[model samples]
Target: GAGVSQSPSNKVTEKGKDVELRCDPISGHTALYWYRQRLGQGLEFLIYFQGNSAPDKSGLPSDRFSAERTGESVSTLTIQRTQQEDSAVYLCASSPHGSLTDTQYFGPGTRLTVL
Candidate 1:
């Protein structure tokens, strides 16, 4: 129905607080990915879920970050005990092939600020 959309466009939390970011991808899309971008830095892949395959979470920086996508639809990124270094924009995208095949769509990211 709609393109990729993320909730809580911005967030502010204490250093040890937990945060959950949600993403709603386009209908029928089989590939979903999560990324993080620090201020002025480029996007870094965090996790990917494609079809029925196990999610590729090798890109996740640490055990504190995790994500899950159910049947190629909604996905959620969770950060536990947030740290200042975790402050950045969390992005979600979906594509038919799961690789930058020209059909990938990126959502407006959720900005996280830790104090």
Candidate 2:
């Protein structure tokens, strides 16, 4: 079976530009997540989607950051008006279910650079 995957493994953009990062989770997985890791920092949760339930977006940093998922499949994270502080590796993960104890399989992050 396939694991989580992200596209455009590296992205370079200027400040004030908009970027969209894509992710594909394991088939049939009921839960998907988006995270961001700043240089030398731990991962920061950005969003979570589970089945048909409303997504948990509390971890999104600001209005500039948003994400969407279609029926537990592909997900996309959009960063508007990119900023230097937004430079980081964007990670995606998936679990069999949206449970606190479920193991999450991670995708190689899409490294974003904001100049």
Best by lDDT: 2
- Model 2 clashing residue pairs (backbone): none
TM-score to native of every candidate shown: 0.94, 0.97
* Candidate 2 ranges beyond 4 A from true positions: none
Ten residues in a row with the worst lDDT in model 2? Answer: 66-75
* lDDT for 5 (candidate 2): 92
C-alpha RMSD of each candidate structure in angstroms: 1.3, 0.8
The clash tally of candidate 2 reads 0
* Model 2: per-residue Cα lDDT over 1-105, one tens digit each: 888999989999999999999999998889999999999999999999999999999999999999989887999999999999999999999999889889999
Separately for all candidates shown, the number of backbone clashes (residues 3 or more apart, or on different chains) is 0, 0
Residue runs of model 1 more than 4 Å from their true location after superposition? 99-102
